[model samples]
Target chain A: MSDLEEYKTVIGLSFGNQNSSISFTKDGKTECLANEEGDRQIPAIFSYQGSEEYHGVQAYGQLVRNSHNTILNFRDMLGKSSEDVTDKKHKRSAKPISVNGQPGFSVTVVDPETGAETTSKKTVYEFTVRHLNRLFESARDFLGKKLDGCVIAVPSDFSEKQIEMLSKASKEAGVPAMQFVKESAAQILALMYSDSALVDKFVVVADFGATRSEVSVASIKSGIITILSNEQDLHLGGEQLTEVLVNFFAKEFEKKHKINPLTNRRAIAKLHAQCEITKRILSNNTTASAAIDSLVDGIDFHSNINRLRFELAGSSIFNKMSDLVVKAVKKAGLETVDINEVILAGGASHSPKLTSLMWSVFPEQTVIRSSASSATPLAVNPAELAAVGAGVQASLIAEFDADEIAGSLTPDVVNAPHLTKPIGINEGDNFVVVFDIETALPAQKSIECVAPAEGGAYIPIYEGERSIKVTTVEADADESDFSEEEEPEEIRERVVTPGTLLATVNIADVAPKAKVEVILHLDAEGKLTVTARPKDGKGSNVRGSN
Target chain B: MSAGKSIPLFPSKTAIEASFVPHAKVSKPVVRSVEPIGPYFLAHARRLKYGRTFSEDER
Candidate 1:
C-alpha cells in the first residue's frame, strides 16, 4: 500500500494555552472535529473529581465549585523550572507547586474504591499528556481508525524547550507529531488555500489571544511565506479586557450591597466567568447584562453595559492593540498602505470594536477578515483558521516518506540570508523600490523606467531605510466662531531615507521619451549587480556590481 | 506521605513503557528522529504547486 493511502487518518492539532482544537481533512474539506461535548474549541483544563477525570467544558465547570482540584493555565508552565514560574498567584485555580525542581500542581483526589482522599502532585507534563490523549482518543473514536500522525500548531514565541516538552508529551500520549507549524503561518495557509487570488500580498496577522496579543507581519510571494517581523504583548489580551468588566460590575455591586466581590475568591471567579459571557454578548449586541446569583453575602448582582461603554472602558487596550499592529508593520520596514490584508485570529478577534479599530489603522483598501465583517467568498472562522490550515498541511505531506519530510522541513534548508533594507532608485524625491526587504538571496528583478527627457540617465541605486514623518495640518478657517481653538490634525506619513549608494549604472545618450530597462540581481553571497540599458538598444549599456 | 512531601505522580516504569508504544505501524517514528524547524521554513518547504486543485479522494 502507498504511504498516502496508509496515512489517511492524520489530523491537525492546535494546542493553545487557553484552548485546543483538532481538525481533519475529509472529502477534500478541512473541518474542526468536535469533542464528545460537541465543542470544537475545547478548554485546555483538566479537573479530577475523586477518581474520575474530566476535560474540556466539563473541566471548565469545575472552576467555580472545585477550584482547588481543577488544573488550568498549566500549558505555559511546561518545560519551566519551579523558579521560572513568575506568576505564582493562581487565585482562580489550583496553585503551582514545585515537584522535583519542575512545576507541578498539588490536587486532592479521592480513591473511588476506598473512599479516601489524598493529595497528588502532578507535573505539568502529565496534564499535557492526558489532555493530548483525550484529543487523540476523540479523533480515533470519530474516525474509527487507530491513527496515522498529526501536525501540531504552535505559537511563534514558544521556546525550544517548551516545544521539546510538548513533543515528548505527545509521544507519550501515543500521538505521532509529524510536524509543528507556527500559528501565524498556519493562519496564512488557511487563507491562501481558500482563495487562489491571495498570492503576492502583505498580511498582518493580529491574534488577540486569551493571555497575550501577538502581531506578525508576513509577506507572501507566489507560494512562499516570509514572516518579516513579530510583536507581542503578554499583558494585553482577552483576560485583561474581561478584568475591566469584572471591575466595573464589582464596583457597581459594591455601591449597592456595601461589599466588594473582588475580595472573595468564589465571588471573583463567578464574576469573571459571567463577565466573559457578557463580553461575548456585547460583541454582537449594543448592550449586554451580567448577573450572578448569590454572588457574595447571599446577594444577586446584576448590571447592564452598552457596547459604547465597554469600548470606552477598554479603549486603552484597544488603542494599544492598534499601536502594536502599527509597530509590527513599521518593524517590517513597510507602511500601512503596503498591507494588503489584516487577518484576525484567536478567540478574542470576534469583537466588532477591534475590527473597526483595525480599519482605522490601515488604508481603506486593506481587507480585514473577522467574524464581524460581511460574509465574502473567502471568509473563514478566525478562531479555526490555524487548525484548518494545519489539517491542510498534514494532508499535503502525509504522502511523503519520513526521510523526505525530515530533509525538507529544516532550518538549514530555508534560513537563507535575505536583504535587510530595500534596494531601489531615487526618482526626484520619491524612492521606488526594486527589491523589497526580506527578499531571499539569489533573487533578481527587472523594471522598466522612463529616462529623463535629455542627457544620459544617471541611475544611482541605494539601500533605503523607512521612517514615519508627522505633519500637522491646520483646521479649516470657515468654521463657526465657537470652534476657534480647535487643534490642528497631525498626519503620519511613511518616508524612506536613502542610505549607502550600492552601485550606479550610467546609460549615456538615451533617446527622448525612451524607456530604459534596469535589472537588479542579488546573489546568495550578498553580492548585488545592477545593469541598465535603453529599450531602443541605441545607447551605451552600463553595468555595475558590489 | 506527609502533606508537603513531594512524590512521583505516576510510576516511572509505566511512564517509560508508555512512551515506546508505536503509534504509526506503517511509518517510521518521526517524533524522535527530527528536530523541530521554524514555522517559516516549514511553510516554505511545503509550498503548494501552482494550479494544483484539491479534489475529493485525491489522496
Candidate 2:
C-alpha cells in the first residue's frame, strides 16, 4: 500500500437519484469509466432474488419481474423520515415503509436451500452504503489501484442534513468523501478548466436529470465561479418525458388489443422500461420503435413513433423546462441578453428538442454548448459532465491534507459575502457598470472616460438594479387586413434602476474632448475609493471613498 | 463670487470617505494546478528516452 501511494489514484462520483457515474482524471484529462457491463451511466438500483443479489443494469432488469423485491429511486429518500415520503405510488418497484421511523423498503428474501421466502426491511441508508461500496469497487477494479479519495458532486438544493447523511454513508462504505461540490459548480468547473477561453461569462447550467430538473445561473470571473440563482422542480425530469411515450404507446396497444396496459402494474413496468429506451433512441433518430414480448395478456406489443410526435406529446413538459430557465435568469437579476453561454448537463439534456427550445428562450447571440450546437467547445456528454468535473476536483485536492480540505468547505468560507448588486457610474441617463455583482472582495477597475464635448462632467457613482421593460408592438393593419390576425409582439428590454447614489465627483474647467481617468478600488473590508484625474492636467482632480 | 463663476482647484492630498458598511471577510480555498499524467505524457516521455514516437494505443 505504501509503495502504491506514489500513484495517487482518485475518482469523481456523480451520484444522482436515478443514476450515478464515476470518473477519473489522467494526464489532466477526465474520462468516465464504464462498469463491468460496459455501462457508464449505472442505474442506482438493487434487487434480491432468493440468495442472489443484482445491481446496476441487472437490477434494472428485475423491475419487471421482481417489482416487489427491486429497490430503485431511493437516493432522494436518504435523510428523510418515513412520514416525509408521502408518495406511496410504487408502480415499478418495492413500496417504501417505515423502519424505525426512517424510510425503508420491504423486500422478500428467498432461501436457496429450503426454498423458503421471507420478508425483510432495508433502510435507505443501508442501500446507499451498499451502492457507494459497489461504485468504489467497480472504480478500483477498473483503475487497478486503491483510490486515494474521491469528490462527490451533489445537488445545490441538498440540505445540510442530507449532505451529512451522504458523508456518513461514504464513511460506512470505506470510501473517503474528500469534498462535496455543487453539481452546477462541478459542471461549470469541468467546462471552464477544459476550455481556457470561458472566463468572465455568465453561464446557465440546465441539469435535466431523470427524477428532477435543476437550473442555475453562474458567473465565472477570473477563474472563480459563483452561483447567482438556482431553481429546481422535483417533479420534472426524464421520467416525465418517458411517461409521455409510455402513454402514447399504451394508447396504441389499447387500440390494437382493446386492453389498456396501464391497468396492470407489471405491464406498466415493462412499458416504462421499453419507453425509456425508445426515448433515448428518439434523441438520436427522428423515429424510434418500442417492442415488448408478453406485454399484457400473453400478447407481444410493437409500435413506432416519430420524433415530431414525441416532441409534441411532451411539449408541455418541455415548455415548463424552458420556463424554469427563464425563471432562473430572472431570479439572477439578469435578462436573457445578459447570459453569455448555456451549458447543458444531465442525461435528459441530450434531447435535441430541448436543445433547440433553448435557442428561443435565450438570445440569438448566446452560445449553447450541447450535442446539437456547433460551438467550438462541443458539449461533453451531459450524463458524465458532473462526474468528470468531480474527477478533476478530486485530482486537484488528492494530495492535500484532509483537514485542510474540510476547512475550505465550511459555510463561512463557501458563503463569503459578495456584492449583491452592481456598482457603476451614471452617464446621462445610462448607467455603465464598472464592477459586476458577485465580484470577490478587494477588487479594482480603472476606466478612461472623455469629458463632455462642451463642458465638464459630473460623474455620479451609484449601485444599480437590473429590470426588464416590456413594450408591445401592434401588428401592421394592412398585413392584418389581408392575412389572418396576428398576435401583438412583446419586446423585453433590459432596464437599470440606479437608486442608491454612493458618491459624486465634480471636475471644473476641463478642456473639450480631454480624457479623464477614473479608478475605483474596493478593499477587503468593503471600503470603496474612487479617484479621478484629467489627463491634460487642466481640470481639478477629485477623490472619494465609501 | 458671481453666480455664473466657478472656482478651479488643484488635486487634494486627502481622500474623501463615504458611509458604507462592509461585511465580514473569510478565507477562500487555494486551487492549485495538478501535474499532467496518463498516456499522452507517457508517450512523450518514451519518445524523449528512446528517440522514437510511440502511439498512445501501445500503452
Candidate 1, B13-45: lDDT as tens digits = 211110111111111111111112333334434
lDDT of each: 0.74, 0.77
Model 2, DockQ value? 0.03
Across A287-366, the per-residue lDDT of candidate 1 in tens digits comes to 99888899998999878999999999988988888899999999987888788899989888887888898888876788
Per-residue lDDT of A1-546 in model 2, one digit per residue for the tens? 686467678899999987899999888788899989999999999999878899999998998888889898887888988898855335578888999999998878889999898888889999999999999999999999888788899988788898899999988887888888888888887777767632456889999998889999987543557688899998889999999999999999999999999999999999999999999999889999889999999999988999999999999999988899999999987789889899888889878888889888876778988865655335578888889888888887787677766655544334434566677776335667666666644445567766665656456677777777888989777777765758776777766766577777767556666777777766545567777888788878777676
TM-score of 1: 0.77
How many clashing residue pairs appear in each of the predictions shown? 0, 2
DockQ top scorer: 2
Candidate 1, CAPRI quality class derived from DockQ: incorrect
List pairs with backbone clashes in candidate 2: A27-B37, A545-B18
